[model samples]
Target chain A: METMLRKREDKIAIIGAGTIGLSFAALHLLKHPTCSIAIYDTRPDVHDYVAEYMSKTLAGAGVDIDSTMQRLRISAYLQEAVLDAVIVQEQGPENLDFKITTWAEIERYAPKTALFWSSTSGIPASQQSRNMQDKTRLLVVHPYNPPHIMPLLEVVPSPRTSQAVIDETLEYWRGIGRTPVVIKKECTGFVANRLAFALFREACSLVTQGVIDVKDLDEVVQNSMGPRWTVAGPFKSYHAGGGDGGLKSFLNKIGGTVQQCWDASEKDVKKGSIAVGEDWQIEVCRQTDEAYGVVDTRERDTRTRSVLEAVSCEEEVQ
Target chain B: METMLRKREDKIAIIGAGTIGLSFAALHLLKHPTCSIAIYDTRPDVHDYVAEYMSKTLAGAGVDIDSTMQRLRISAYLQEAVLDAVIVQEQGPENLDFKITTWAEIERYAPKTALFWSSTSGIPASQQSRNMQDKTRLLVVHPYNPPHIMPLLEVVPSPRTSQAVIDETLEYWRGIGRTPVVIKKECTGFVANRLAFALFREACSLVTQGVIDVKDLDEVVQNSMGPRWTVAGPFKSYHAGGGDGGLKSFLNKIGGTVQQCWDASEKDVKKGSIAVGEDWQIEVCRQTDEAYGVVDTRERDTRTRSVLEAVSCEEEVQ
Candidate 1:
């Protein structure tokens, strides 16, 4: 009766349906209503919980829950799930040994045309798929925490990954409303966390030295560069700093100092100096105290949801 | 008669009634209604323009204008302005020679008790006050661009700055609804910019290598680290990354990769690379033609203003 029955080839399979995997399946179904999604997990009943959560979320967001659910299915076996899929999103544990074993299995079972992506953050795709005969089809698509809400998806390629695979994966990521930044040259942790941790190391160094308290250190970023960085990156900020002439002018005047300071900051990755001192009693703290921590987290979550909703509704408005 | 009729003991002299100087004066007046503010500038009718702008801003924000203005008074000569002032906020041009001359003159005329603070991002406070006789009282209070809207003020003390001076300046900065993060050890661009640029240098390097484009580079920060950095610095981000264990667990898990990848990236900071190209306009065209050239600049500016406004209001509410 409908044209939908004719195009069943566009299918997605999600392996190891944990938090990241379930989120990917839900989001894929949300974006591609006509495309089917089959989720595989070692544990039973996790799919039921995921399905329930998705239905509630869709209802909360005023989306069509029945239609969204119609495109989603579940399987207990990865071999049966990914046999005819267009893409396979793997979200197994971060342990390297486990990933290597699973990835090799994925390479054996997944269709040749399917673009397989591992949601691993620390492990490089190259190392995981080294023994696979057709490793070029595999890449790392690491998403941030609460993957459904946060938009960053680090698309890192292995040395063997083809250009077409990267381009197709990029298209898939964008189509699903995720902000994907491709790592042309793959390195562990890709770009964001490495750069971030460098700053973290310096902040810890200062805090350890008693230069400032923890709260004040957070304030420094929240009120200062954090706001500016939301709009532009560091290079552009320096460009504006040069006032009229841009980066060249800024470096010409402050280049020596920048270099000197950078040299001083260089150190091998050190362990964190501070440790959580005690376990807190939830009963001792009042509702207000608990609410305070939740307030900031909730606000950030709301902002994220708003951004995603805006992106999804853009076409309708146009 | 009330105590309001009595003359205030503490006075602040603002050297150069530019945007920053005037905003500092207004902010101080808002906090301490009775504190005397005497502004000095070579430019004629500058105070009048500042006064007009402040009135409009205050009115828009539902603040009292005339009463606030009563705390402020402008003078034409530097000597007449700094006669009895306890703090001198120097917002002069960003030139080494100008700063050297200005500091020397301020040291010559101002009382021995007066502390001099330069609002310079480019010149280190140590370098600027190298020749001053009372360099111990000289420090740098480098605020973010458009100082009035931002609350981050980097209080960088020179080698000669006394403990007393730093403490008093910290008190003064806090009294005006501002947060001051001390630079216990001074380096180029202080803390925020140096950390910011380190990331920027890597981004440029990635682009130059054709690993990632300009737009994707921005997306990586926003979706991943940028939003989190708004609430927490890198240390805390990693701390949370540990899931429940905090920083120690996070680093322990990722420590190997961090060390491996620390040396993975090249550390050279060059001018605009071929990836970004010399002209950002042409580079943007190659990356994303729709948002290239003039349209990109306008979009960036609009986004910048929006973020600034959003964060300012959010902080105020908190």
Candidate 2:
């Protein structure tokens, strides 16, 4: 793999130098020790950001920082970045018009055969590729926050995306040490965020209604579902929870309670009814700040890395 | 703690030797190696169940099985079980009538000063203590499944429960190596399950909606929010995700997207509308079984323990 990456054919273009873009650059550089990375960004501080990222992730990269720096080149022009790349990863702005224009220009400049992977959290490939002449190879490969650390990527393809490209995209993410789950159908927010924010909304409601405070809610979750889901997902946990009857029995037994909560959910999770500066919102944020604001993010990053390493390889459900 | 537990007065009674009951006994015995426990249950197989539980958790308990067993005494009568217990932990059936009658009887037989703790998952202390002459000390002490290892104990006090007892209960659980979160107000399902099931219902909707499959959803969660929440709960994560703006900014930024999901949520999480024996239920169960059935629960338990141990002591908030 190292020898193969040394070839010019292995060059990959990164079409943004923001947090996600730089993270993708750093990790990809770490992943393939000999591969070249071309990062394109109009930001004046793009080079400084890359330097700062290197200093933070240097020890973890397990390779010479100088060579990585040598291999990484910044391009002001998008044409220079995608000139001879095998894969083009676009982590540009989330605006729809911006994405359409950028992708169209990327297609015109880059090799026609290059894989177009957009790291858009919410945008679907269908809309992102609308302005492109040939949308055959374009797709959405959305990662969780801090793309380099979190391995999950939502691989969503436009209807025009070729089946071969989808398979290759999944293969590429896996080869890069990512756990990619292909979305069979595209929708807003995808799977993880929809599930995450759904739970978060209910939690907000609980805190607002004075059922439980923010810090206690955090502790309750950390000690319970946080670790449980880290081991197995919802269906697996519910199935195992059912004893012998599986999910059917679990539903029959606990479904009513869940339903009761759901019935009362409207009182808590108002349909997008979060007034940004509301009193409850202010108090909850203050509580969170008091409780968790003390712990620096470095500690969190360490915790995240340790927890991910401990359980990521233990998936029972393929 | 060991020397303190050796006293004759440091005795606790465990009522009902079902799965939860036995697990509680094992962990308590492990937590206080020299403390005595009296277990009472109507099941003829109760002793066998304890013996099996000891065998399973023996290595993890780090105490001599012989000594632990000697300290644990199973009684046929509730009167004998609560004879000289400093605390009475009732893990009886979920039936409300059974709890009301049992608590009344326990109050009559046990020392009037014994701390009353009910391990009822849903039945609140308010309901469980209906027939008790004195409900001052009684409160709901609910644990996540396999109570010994998963350290979450929801310490809920009824409207009548004394504040001193609530504080004492939280301290006791913490001493037993459990992460106790005080539920400020009593509500059905409490904090953890409500948050868990809320997230779970949305996951169900996503799977049923054909947006993602069961196993891939597991992978997505295991890779994303599962590990994330393990580090910091939803509030902290969002607060950090907002860059400099905190959760208020986070709400303003992604609030619209979250609301969009919430608006569409009803079509999926239809007020606990899970048909227990429906086609989706059967198919999902089949998929779960096919995916996770082959992996024996021992593996899951081990995974749960490791993940819990990795993050339990790292709480940023008290």
Candidate 3:
């Protein structure tokens, strides 16, 4: 694992230069400065957009735009893009048919040893590669929004995925400064999205119950658990809660309270369920846009990068 | 609201100088430098412990210890603590009988205008103030653990709580550089804990189901959704997901996927439910302690403070 991680200069192929694909391109350049990236997007204009996006996003992280761009190759043909690739990251649309088609193309052209990684957030790789000739190297490598900044990468493997592929994928992501967690079993939404949606359900329930307004609910999270989770995960946080006794003491003292909270949560979920009504959703979207529209994206990205940098610098110093 | 926020020098009383109470005292001193504090605890040595804790914690936040300590008064008697107080924050143990006894004593001594705030996480303010003569002034002002650093304060009011008290409490918290979200109706766990427990259930389910190791699970959250949430809440994040159309577009495209994830989550919950088994919890605590022991608390607090300070500074500039 250590040796694999030390080898950072892998020939990477990025298929489908959409929003996620573009973000991955920037992330690869910023994280693996020595690696070369080949971007294959069906659209002719994807190269220019990716170039501009990478320059804007990576420049803030201190990446030299011209030199980094020199190592990037934009190919309109799939064979030309992935023929010599060591890792093929497919960030195509979420549709199964489109994914199967893209996977077949990559498997046909890319080197047999190259790992076939999908950026599908929800779909399992097994289903996406069902029609492919070989599926052992195919797996899901889902990332959260703005992959260049967020360090979480869910390296989910299908049943047929080989041990070497999993190990190499993990090593590569770690080498690129990503915190990759392997999903032992294939599950919908994986870990991050499942946890995210769980919280989202309750946030919606609170809004419906008038427990808090949309804006204030956001504030509550941003101020408290947001930073808390950033420093310590839930289990670690509870462990800290127990003083010297650790999680055992915390559970003994407050386990009943957690159960009670869960029980009460069921009632709240029913009482003030998140309405999927179009008008209600539009209103929420309007309010959300009003609060954090596109104009604030640059500021938000900058802040997230600053926090990550601070945390990483602290870790290095320690 | 703006004018009320300007008044910072309130005479405050903190009953029960335990962990939470001491934290509240430190927070008040750090945030409101001019406010005088009176602390009441049954334990005779609480003053020394609180003083040591405050001195150690506040020094990291660049607070002037000597000046802050001069305004702090430790009292063994309840009357002495609440006699002339304008705000009395009660952080007693989670016992109804004991809380009633303490509240009765506080009401008997504290001035009529003093706002009665309970730091109880589970019990509602209404239930706590059931035995009090004047319930109108009572409310719940629950803070996340280590109140001096984490900025979330759930300002939940009982039905009998006066509007003036609510408004003043909001203004006061904001004045102290805290983000307080008002809970419109009394509910168990309120918003933050409900959201927290919601995520915890899934986390436990994942661990139990062999989906991810406890350490890896923590890494997944600490790296991905944790920081993403610190910058933008769920609603706002989804808004960004939908290119220019905002959250409406995001929902329109992926609402069905969200529902599917929720459905899959229900099955997963039943498969690997969070067990409060004593031995299992102990093992988890041990691992957690090994990963993030007491020595790391200072580093954790420093990192959290850095993130909060950076965020607040950005907000001010915006």
Which residue pairs show backbone clashes in model 1? B239-B247
**lDDT for each residue of candidate 1 in A133-164, tens digit (9 for 90 to 100):** 88788899988876767778889988898888
2 or 3: which has the higher DockQ? 3
Question: lDDT for every model?
Answer: 0.67, 0.81, 0.81
> Scoring each candidate complex against the real one, what DockQ results?
0.25, 0.59, 0.60
CAPRI level of candidate 1 = acceptable
Off by over 4 Å in 3: A1-10, A58-64, A131-133, A273-295, B1-10, B63-67, B275-295
Clash count in backbone of candidate 1: 1
Instruction: Give the candidates in order of TM-score, highest first.
Output: 2, 3, 1
Over A114-153, each residue of candidate 3 has an lDDT whose tens digit, in order, gives 8889999888989999878988889999988878778888
lDDT per residue (tens digit) for residues B1-318 in model 2: 333345655788999888888888888888876578899999888778788877787766567778778888889899999987878999988899999999999999898667899998789899888988888879988989888778889999999999878877776776667789889888878888888888877887788777888899998888888888888888888888876777767788777787777667766655435444445666666777777664456678788777766665454432
Q: What is the lDDT, from 0 to 100, of the residue A179 in candidate 1?
A: 80
Per-residue lDDT value at A176 in model 3:
72
Best candidate (score: DockQ):
3
lDDT of 3 by residue, B26-85 (tens): 888777766889998888688679878778877857767887898898887889989888
